[model samples]
Target chain A: MADHEHKDNEQLGAAGFNRRGLLKCMAWAGTGVLWTVNGGVPRSLGLLGEAAAAESHAGGLTFLQISDSHVGFDKPANPNALGTFQEAIAKIKAMPTQPAFIVHTGDITHLSKDKEFDDADQAMKALKQKVHVIPGEHDVADADNGKAYLDRYGKGTQGRGWYSFDAGGVHFIALINVFNFQPGFKSAGLAQLGDEQLEWMEKDVKGLSSSTPIVVLAHLPLWTVYENWGWGTEDAPRALGYLKRFGSVTVLNGHIHQIQQKIEGNVSFHTARSTAFPQPAPGSAPAPGPMKVPAEQLHSVLGVRTVNYIRGKSPLAIVDTPLSA
Target chain B: MLRTRAVLLGGAALSAMLCAAAPAVISGGGPALAAAKAASVKIDNFNFTPPTLVVEPGTTVTWTNADDSPHSVREMDGRFKSAALDTDDSFSQTFSAPGQYQYFCSIHPRMVGKIIVQPAGKTSSN
Candidate 1:
């Protein structure tokens, strides 16, 4: 993708275009444009803007998203989740190109046992890259205040394990909405980002320019995919409001252990497949849980997602590759 | 004289009395057979088999996790709560108060169940 600002300027030199006219010009360019405001005026940049602009200095940024490892689970769906988890890691190891890091959305274990965490830790260590993890309900089912999870993955996170970081000119926010869930509904309970975290999130993004790409990571879906199964977050709208100003937003989650995607305006929502086992599609079964599949077909549904960031062209370019595929 | 002759010849009145008593026998000696009341709600397929149950005020209700996943029973109004129960694990609560108590699994909220406790000494018909 190429920037046409200088060429377009020559053609429209004395015309003095309005906002609508500029957008029309952007469309005419036939390329994804990243729009930013400078000095109270809107300007468009070429596809693969800043992130790719530095390809010579540092390679193009790429990250792997893996979730629902369920290390200790021993069920018919996938009797040895640990074995499949190793397969997932092997797939990452065999990738022709390496990702900068791996973000584990949640559910690193079936039960938050020390051995489970240890198995997950040893498996993830094989990748040899930084692994960022948030907790799923299963990880905290045995520990109060998430002491067990915190001891492993919650080193610098604040208030139930939510934090943000900057990588390759893109902002990534890791949130925890699985705590204090309202019980008896279904699945993971309608996810919630409490008042304290929501307040912190608003201030966190207050200083970011709208052009910066924002990636929100949590265990449960931020939007209402299926409330009856507690597959949605209750107060995600409040958290989303803080992100409205950003030009690009991508939300990633993994409690459902299926591949689901949604795009709303400038925001895109994606739930990755599990490395442990497959779950039935929403409403396809009586409820969401370990969906036993034919032994041969087990690997076809569980895998990891690789996201490539091209600056001006909507930083989130997600490609899901199953263990078999 | 005609009624006496009919009863002696066919025994129709006695048969009718036995016919009426058959249902009572099948229903386990009427509602007074308190030992046979359904007092447990089996949680399987992520649901409460009998979504609603009725029993005497002093009856104890047991919820068993028959599914392979973990679950918990929690009262909607904060009256009772259970810890995370793995497969085959069970939790029980006795309803001494005569009222409706709604509860759900904390792990799977949609799996809701209701228990109606009748007044003291009253047993629910199966």
Candidate 2:
């Protein structure tokens, strides 16, 4: 691993490129690529080698994003969802620079059973960092309409497990969009943030300065992506409208189970991969479900994301490393 | 367990009747016997097979999930709602009254279905 990291640094040095040249030549250099934003333009800094090492030592705030663990899922796609989730935890435990915390975007269980929540909790207990979680639709499937999820994780949260906090000079807001799923109630057949949560969010950021970097975390995509598959949120445009005053806003979501990113004005939206099993790309399959890939390639398609924030930097740096890589 | 066995036997009997090309006389059964008439809805590839099912009153509608994802059967008017059904899992609802009921998979709302229960003694419109 050290040799690979060294080689990556050597290639960049050999190019004898300035910052502008590096930005122009930068392709998505596979796994471990660090993405930083400057003037709302994202640049991929290939490989997490010297640059990441320096940032870690410089006291930057780094965190992990793990989503869709689906702890009770035991299907052909990936027979041991819990096992893979634990493997992701192990990877985070072994990171060279420990992250400050972890934000699990949701789907923490398959059926929202008590035992499934217990199993996922036991596995997550292995991580040294505190975890911030929002419920995926699966987590709230209990007969009581999410009472089970609220019992265990609802402390300090408001209105169906949404809350905000300040971390590393960044304002972090966790929203819940996987509710209000009664029959005939429709949000274009997609997830929704609802009126109460939207109002709370508006007041949540009222005191923040325009320069404050805001990170919005939810279980579903904040923007519409493949409406037929329910991959996007219905009222996300309204929620996003509130953040327009902020100079830098990053919305992190997880329900899609694959990485899809979009940039609009000063906002950047990113979806993370699932730790349980991969789903087909939007509109690629007959429907959106656990996508069965070649058994050998499963690990490569499933992994975690790391985000680093430096105080003076305009936007946070994001690194996505596959488990196999 | 008894309910499951009864539903299975009822399904078998229904299939046999259909195979024999007999007139569907699914009426005039006692309370115990009335619970035996079964109609099925198959959930595969995120869509309900036989999306619109018309059956005689007192027929039990069973939804079987065949896809890898989990789905729940919930009526639009909140008459009945099932827990999440994983692959091979099934949920059954007995419609005693005659009316049209709309339902959808609460997990994936895009997948919708309908059930119409006509007055007793009428053949299934299907």
Candidate 3:
């Protein structure tokens, strides 16, 4: 495998970039899971040293990130959504340091059925912890109608489903971009925070100090993943512009299903993994949908990321460690 | 251990009744299924495409290589594995039993999918 370390400037063709060892990029096969690694090293994120662990890190926070947990989805690609989701939770519980809270980026359910939500909810219930949620396109198909998912999960959130909270002196914002969408943009899939919510988000963070650590969670990549497939958000530019001033901003999204990252200034953006099944790389397949794999080895993909916010002069650390590892 | 579902539809198997989605002929609805058309799934970033699929019993589910890279289609217990299929190459398996088959690219287990197999010669439940 090459250096497992993901190089910002170096680009791996969306598909079949030869990687040695376990660092190889996972691809979509028949009815099985593929583990695809970019370059070699899965991003070597910096961890905060001393001073921050003693709780004196005041605005210090570490949280678990789980995305694309497509519950109620029963496919050869991923036969067991509940089990994988549990595995993901187990990874979260086994974290070296327990995060202050948990964030589910999106795709909590595959078909977005009530039972699917319940299944995901059941798995989460075992954690015995408070969870913050942001809806993905799968969860908010009926926004034009009262069936908007925000109504069910958007407690104390803003706009259709965007909301902000304060923890450890840092401002945590969750936005809903699955609202308005355009055609051929299926990659980013259709994220919209409604004008009402976007306006509110601007005002909500207007007064916060640029130094305060900000964690933003949405469903789609705020940046571009694959322009051909619309693998990025249409309106994220405006949203990022708002956070550009913040010295340490961490933006997280879930739509891509793969882990891709980029650091633009103080902002570190990451895409999360799904608790359900894995998808193929953009353009690697004919079209986007549930990918199939063999029946076994499904657990390897069930991983979680831990983000630790430390005080002092150190920047916040985000780790995408897989549960299957 | 990975899990697979084996659901017995409650209603009669007469008409092809699709549920929760469009009234299309097929696309993984109900406890039933259909044969899968050979296709490729996207996995460059970290997701599956057509994340769900339903096929009739005995349908050979083939995952082809559409990208320049190589990939596999294997089961959880090492029950199956596809030698890396290069670009344009393909792999296939016949789903004979009526049950849910969840699989992933052994190379990249995160690339997951589900294949719901239905009882042969049946569709809707009334």
Best by DockQ: 2
How well is each residue in A1-325 modelled by candidate 2, as lDDT tens digits? 2233233334434222343333223212224446665544445555656465346434678888999999999999999999999999999998888889999999999998999999999999999889999999999877566889999999999987899988998899999988864333244478789999999999999888999988999998998767778777878999999999988899899988776666778887778888888887666677899988777878877788888887877557777766666
Error of 1 at A113 (Å): 2.9
For model 1, fnat equals 0.40
Interface Cα RMSD, each model: 3.6, 2.5, 14.8
Worst lDDT 10-window in candidate 3 chain A = A29-38
Q: Candidate 1, residues B1-126: lDDT per residue as tens digits?
A: 322332232323323323332222111123343453347888888888677666665566778988888777776655666666768878777665555566776556657766666654433311
Best by lDDT: 2
TM-score, predicted candidate 2 vs. hidden true structure? 0.83
Candidate 1 Cα deviation (angstroms), residue A164? 1.1
- What would the DockQ be for model 3? 0.02
Who is ahead in lDDT, 2 or 3? 2
> A317, model 2: CA deviation in Å?
0.6
Tell me the tens digit of each residue's lDDT in model 2 across B1-126: 323333333333333323434333323335675546788999998888777776767788889999999998876645677888999999888776665566788788878777666665444323
Better of 2 and 3 by DockQ: 2
Cα error of candidate 3 at position A247, Å: 0.7
lDDT-better candidate, 1 vs 2: 2
**Evaluated with TM-score, which candidate comes out highest?**
2
